[model samples]
Target: MARLESTLMAFRAKNGFDRGIAAPQIGVQNRFVAIHLVGKHASPQEDALPQAESELFQHELNHLVGILAVNLVSKDLLSADELLNRFPSHVI
Candidate 1:
């Protein structure tokens, strides 16, 4: 959770995204990753897990950065169409 959070935080500060992902809600097969997306307007609900404060922040952050990166690339700012086209599959 801590590692994932760190990755999220780095991603957040860059993209300004606001989305939240509910792990239990989606049945990810493992508790390793719970939340999926937390957008800029959404609130961190009380139902959230008891993650380390820093870890939670980081995880959300990662999602934010991811959204921004995808948007930028899709906009032609980056040149990796072939790879992006097969996203959530072709590997990052």
Candidate 2:
């Protein structure tokens, strides 16, 4: 949780805004999510994320369930070999 919080904080600091983060985003193969709400974003009885915190949670949930973001797309997707070939002598 702490790591997620720190990562989320750093992301928000760099990007100006962030809704949440998942453990997998930091290479943790566990199910954990961290949501941040501050000042006006801390709405009464709810979080006031314009993109919706629930949606962010759902995105993270997909990661916990072993669903990659790339899998969500069905058009012009690259195979492992093809994707790896585009790497500049380093692998993702």
Candidate 3:
């Protein structure tokens, strides 16, 4: 995992964006992924748990097929707020 961390650090240094990088981007087929949430606003664990696991897996699967999150969101299909509201939530 050292190599993954190092690569994430290097990308952060060069791109100035703090986000996670999937293993497929680096040609690793070990089915491992890393997320770097440093210095970001994180959602509450309880609230995020319902959808986080499925979302994370779907996200990685999308990457494997060259699809991105942005591609799934379009004003024609659904607004951002509408999409956010579709996820199951514990708190009203």
* Number of the predicted model whose TM-score against the real structure is largest: 2
* Rank by TM-score (best first): 2, 3, 1
Please tell me which model should have the higher lDDT, number 2 or number 3. 2
lDDT of 3 at 30: 60
lDDT of 3 by residue, 1-92 (tens): 67777888899999987456677778886666666643444576644433555476568667767778889886666566766777547325
Q: What lDDT does each candidate get?
A: 0.47, 0.77, 0.68
C-alpha lDDT (0 to 100) for residue 46 of candidate 1: 56
Clashing pairs in 3: none
TM-score of each: 0.26, 0.57, 0.51
- Give one digit per residue, the lDDT tens place, for model 2 in 1-92: 88899999999899998877778879997889787754455458864445665567677788788887788986977778987887647764
Per-residue lDDT of candidate 1, residues 12-63 (tens digit): 6788753344233233333444344434434576555444544555554554
Clashing pairs in 2: none
TM-score of 2: 0.57
Clashes of each: 19, 0, 0
Q: In model 2, which runs have C-alpha deviations exceeding 4 angstroms?
A: 37-51, 76-92
What lDDT score goes with residue 11 in model 2?
Answer: 92
